[model samples]
Target: MEMLSTISGWIWNPLAYVALGIGVLFTLLTKGVQFRRFPDMIRHLRSGGATEGGLSSLQTLALSLSSRIGVGSIAGVATAVAAGGPGALVWMVITALLGSTCAYAESVLAQVYKRREHGEDRGGMPYYIKYGLKAPWLATIVAVATLIGYGFVFPGVQANNIASSAELAFGVDGQVVGVLIAVVLGVVVLGGTRRIVKVVEAIVPFLAVGYILSALVIIGMNITKVPDAVVLIVSSATGKDQVFGGIVGYAVAWGVRRAVFASATGLGEGTFVAAAATTTHPGKQGIIQAFSIYIDILLICTASGLLLVVTGAYNVKDPAGGFLVEHVPGAVAGPNFMQEAIDSSLPGWGAVFVAIAVAMFAFTSMVFFFYVAQTNLVFLLGERRSKVLEAVVKAGAPAIAFIGSSVTADAMWAAGDIGYGILGWLNMACVLLLTPVVRKVIRDYDRQRREGLDPHFDPGPLGIKGAEYWETQKEPVKEPDRV
Candidate 1:
């Protein structure tokens, strides 16, 4: 336990924080593509249903969001404030604004390098890393690591939180909930990606919109306190808020860490769905992914943070393992912060409501983990892969969730942190290496739109190769490959 905590802290504090600058650089280099394409992204959201054995663009978007908006947006936010204080919220907002560009780059690249697999469009960090960087070894490393980290470790965190929250809110047996979660998830997951996509397409919108509306109601009730909370967040971030002065450094680090954890901008998980989308242009799905970054951080993460901070249903713990301040006495932090925040506002039924909401939110994330694991297993096995390996992973995934019910919340979160930290760093490096390819995709996409033509990816005409699924029998158009 001690070792896990130490490793997780080391990765999140200095390593993840420095790596965040890469996203900021991407935002600047793209000249803020996320903002420029904002309206176009909204229009693209109309896409849905299955075709050509792949998820529709909108379903893919929901799949990506469902995978992202898990315990991180709820429990993870509370953990950040507990460790880093209110100032951390300010850094989270900053991370989202900048990280959108990084999200755009990776999502488009995934679409560009994707391959047709299992009669469906499927690709991810591994596909882009291998095809774009031409480093199959590194790609293999990432695939296996992702299979372990997300497939095993991160799902444990979500499961653990679900158990803990349900037990606290409704007096249900955490063990029973774990089994039920495993059974339900196994059913959906065994149905394959299509079923998962179909369900998440329904589940994501309901949970997200419902949570947003609940947040707005809480915020409206305490609307007058909103301004001061925002002010305090900014002040604490800049070291100008004397109340949180001593912890500004922790605030900045934890804020950015929590945002990365919640928004998943650089974690490479987004590519799983991005590569599976049936979109006309790779950049179109990329733009939609950019919007998801904002949705997770700007919308969900902030909602969780504001709900706690405005109501003073929050507490902070110093690194010395002592309370820095206690706004909510005896709250014990973590998911309890959000539960108590809602409970304080609405009383009796609040805890039960949040518990049900979290169960659905976390269940969606659990489903994604299995798909990711299966995807990587398929990648490692190539054509020689068998159902035996698939069955083993399928059983192992839910088993971890079951065991996680008995584990401590902090330990599970720490394990997940370590997984995401390593994967996020590796994926970011790969994106940086593939800069020219992403630049070319963007140039081609933008040129078509400017010419008043509907933009579609034509790698042959654009003089790019290694896009296995995108290749055509048509002759390549000779053009200088300059992006």
Candidate 2:
């Protein structure tokens, strides 16, 4: 545990600044496309239709959201508040707003550099780094890192959270919950990517909507306390609040760290799923992906933060030891904080409600995690598929999920942080190096929109090479139906 924490600290201590800088840089390079193309994001989201082998824009959104809006939204928000105070919530919102641009840049590059594999579109940081930059070695490193991170290290965190929440909600044992999660996940994962996509597309909306509505009910019930909660968040974030003024640095650090962990702006998680979409233009998919950051941090994470603050159901821990603020004296930082918040308003329901929500959210996220790992596995073995290697990932993912549920949350979280930090470092470097390519693509996309024509990608004329998939295309891919 100590070693894991040490590694995590080494990776993440400077990562927040790195992530922020890249986000700011991308925003400038793209001329703030996340904001300027806000309307187009919405229109293009509905415009993209899926071909026989690819996902529609909305389906890709759901797959990405499945990973984005998982335990991070609930349990991650609780940890941020407990460690960084309500002020952390403010920084989380800031990270998402800026990071949305990073999301746009990476997603655009992913689409531009995508390749067809096994009759399905497959691309991401690895593909772009390999094909776009012509560095197969660096791409191999990225693919291996992604496979290890998403496949083995990260799933445990989600599984740990789900098991802990379930154990708290019901008296079920962690091992039992772990086994159940592995079994359920195995059934879906064995069915491959299409099954995973269909399942996520069905459940992501319901999970998001249901969780948000519950938050609204809690907020509406405590309408009188809303202003005070908002004030606490703002003042604490700026080091103005009397109670939380001392740890303003911690607020920014934890908020940005947790927000990046939650929304995965530049980590290349969304880039993999984004590359799987069938869209007219790379920018359209990029814009849709940017909007997902809003759904994740702006709506879902905010809901979690508000639930904790308004109800005073959280305990703030001082990094130096002891409590800075302890609204719930015995409660540690986790989903229980939100569960307690819900219970404060609706008796006997918080644990059960949070348990179910976390289960579904974590489950969908685990599925997406497997897809990311599988995608990278394919990238690693280009034109050489090994059944033994495939079976290892197929079986190992669920095995880790089960093991994660039975272990301590602290260890799992530390491991997850290290994985995210490493991926961020690798993918960010690739994104920054390829900024010129992204810039040209964005300009092309913007020019077509301004000319009153739906954008179509033709990489050759733009001097963008390595987009072999788009180079052969003459017109936009046809849509199957709106979904």
Candidate 3:
């Protein structure tokens, strides 16, 4: 317990405040671009656009949702509750609302400065950090951090979750489930973003809608307790509860941390998706991606939180005891609350639904993370040995999943906490320094849009020539031997 506390402290430490600070600062700098163009974003996504490279708006949305909905919704939310309590859900919503605006700015900046690689438009935090900011080294560092955090270690965690959920839901062996997930991931991701988009586009909408509807049904069934549940969540957050004492600060911080971690508004995943959008205006896609935070954190996470609260399951003590003793004792960890809610209505099926939802969401998240990692790997390693690096990273998932399945819930919760903490700090620093560039890009887009220029804002007005300003910083690369 002491080790868990220490680790949770390290991961959800005040330093994560830095990520929020930067995100808020960028949001302000962009002059509320997210809110201003919120409608235009929808129009663009539906209308579509002509781009030589990059993904359709639906594809971009699918990709971003794939990552956001995964472990963050399932394991991540549960983990936050375990560490900080139900009050943390409030912080998560607050962060998502604010952080998503910053998500828009950064992603738009990436889109404006995106480059063509192998017939596709490829850009992200690295593209903007390096080219837009004219800080090649900073871009390199940010890209490396993103590759490891989003792509490598993150995918392992997602895979672990999918395997665990499948085993719990369908009585499948963990190893067998892991292999199945890995095989599905390999098949889709190996085909690249085109295939990845198809797979996520097919699955994400149905899965998300299904989970939300199911939660609503459960909540409806327990409508009588709605007021009491809201009071508990709000009271816990405000420290009105005597049990919480004077630890309102702890609750507040935990909520903020969990929300940002869940939505991932500015943690580089949104930028990757924005860059992939086939659009005329970078800001348009940015706006669409920004809304994702709302859907993910505000809609999905909140529903899950409300479901847990409304059902009186959040207070359960032994989540692993299955649905029978579920959530009544108020456990210190895991989804005892949710498990109990499901158990109350569907008997044994509650666990099964959760397991299935977790498996689908987490599996897709693994695929999304691997793609992000592979993209950044190419950026850092150049086109030559990127394949080797990618293979190594993908291979690490099974081992991690195996370990995660065998471990206790407390340890898994702590590990995820530590990961969010470390990655948040590094990402926040990079995003803050490059914020001015985001501002410039947004201002430029606004100027263009006002002129009735079709909202086509390109950081590189002359294509590759605009990229040259930043290219001078990198050393010449020797050609690698080809087969």
Candidate 4:
């Protein structure tokens, strides 16, 4: 346990700084792409509905959101508050605000450099890391690292959380919950990206809305406390809180970590999602993905944070130890934190509702994590449409799930934290090198939009137009008609 904690600390501590720096840099370099494109993005994603062989922009966003809006939103908040203090919630909002821009840039770069393979369009950090940065070796390193993170460590953590929570809430055995989760995950993963997208599209909306409404009801029940909670968040964020005991720094780091974990900005994993889109223009898909960060971080995570703070469930001391803790016997710390908060105000069924919500939230994330691992594997092994790949993924999912349930939650979190830290450094390094290319793509898209031209026009081979990196790596000019 000590070793895992040390390992996780080593990974998370340094990478947090790097993630923050890269996030700030990209937010500045891109002229707030997240802010400018947010409204346009919302409309674009909604403009088309899902179609066969392809996800509509909204479906794509929903799928990505499903992966993000899980334990990270609930448990992550609890963890952050526990580690840092109530002030952490304030930092989370700031982190999400900045990190969402990074998400925009990376998603755009992924779209710009995306390629088609096996009758499907695919693109992500691997593409940009290899082709855009001309660093194939580094790209390969990141790909392998990411696969291990997703395939091995990440699922175990997800499973453990689910099992622990289920054991508490339902009196079901932990192993039973683990096996059930594994089976469900196996079914979703075997169905491939298209199937995953379909499932996410169906579930994400209902689940997210349900979670938010429940949270709002809790907040309304505690309506008188809302003003004080808001004041606490704002004051603590700015270091003006009366009970200042490292609260400012604690809040900032806590908030940032939760936002990063929830939205996955700079993680480079979400790009696989864009790779599966059916859009002619990768830019369109990228734009849609960028918007997902906002939905996940700004909306979902913030809602969870507010619920905890407003309800006074942000317990300062408990074994779970955070603003997101409660006194429920069978409740997992985070949801119980919120549950207890609600229960205090509403009584009786509050914990039950929160328990159900947490189960669904955690379950959705488990499926999403599997999809990330599957994509990384496909990238490394060369996309062979056979049962071999499917078999490996299927087997791995359940195995990881079983391991997850058996392990301690803290140990699982520590392991996941380590993986996420390595991923952040690798991903941010790539983003820094590719920022210019991302900028160029955005400029070109904006120009085309202004001039009433198709935004999907290939800008390469004509001196690689906007991006300096692409300018130097230009392929030989082909006949204009030879797309």
Q: What's the alpha carbon RMSD for model 3?
A: 6.2
Per-residue alpha-carbon lDDT of candidate 4 for residues 191-211, written as tens digits (9 for 90 to 100): 877777667778888998888
Q: Model 2 over residues 1-483: C-alpha lDDT tens digits?
A: 989988987898689888888888888888898888899878877775777778998899999999999999999999989878999999999999899999998999999999999999999989999988899999999999899888888989999999888988998999999999999999999998889998999999999999999999999999999999999999999999997999998899889999999999889999999999998788889999999999999999999999899999999988788998888877758888988999999989999999999999999999999999999999998889999999999997789989999989988898899889999999888888999998998999889988998788888889998898888777656656775
Residue 208, candidate 3: Cα error in Å is 1.1
What is the C-alpha lDDT profile of model 1 across 24-110, one tens digit per residue? 788777778888878888777764445665666677778888977887888888988888899898888888988888889999999
| Candidate 2 deviant stretches above 4 angstroms | 474-476
By TM-score, the candidates rank as 2, 1, 4, 3
The better-scoring model by lDDT among 2 and 3 is: 2
When 1 and 4 are scored with TM-score, the better candidate is 1
- lDDT leader: 2
Q: Tell me the lDDT of model 4 at 366.
A: 70
Model 2 pairs in collision: none
Reference-based TM-score, model 2: 0.98
TM-score of each: 0.95, 0.98, 0.86, 0.89
* Alpha-carbon shift of residue 153 in model 3 (angstroms): 1.7
Write down the lDDT of every candidate, Cα atoms only.
0.83, 0.91, 0.68, 0.70
Backbone clashes in candidate 3 total 11
lDDT of 3: 0.68
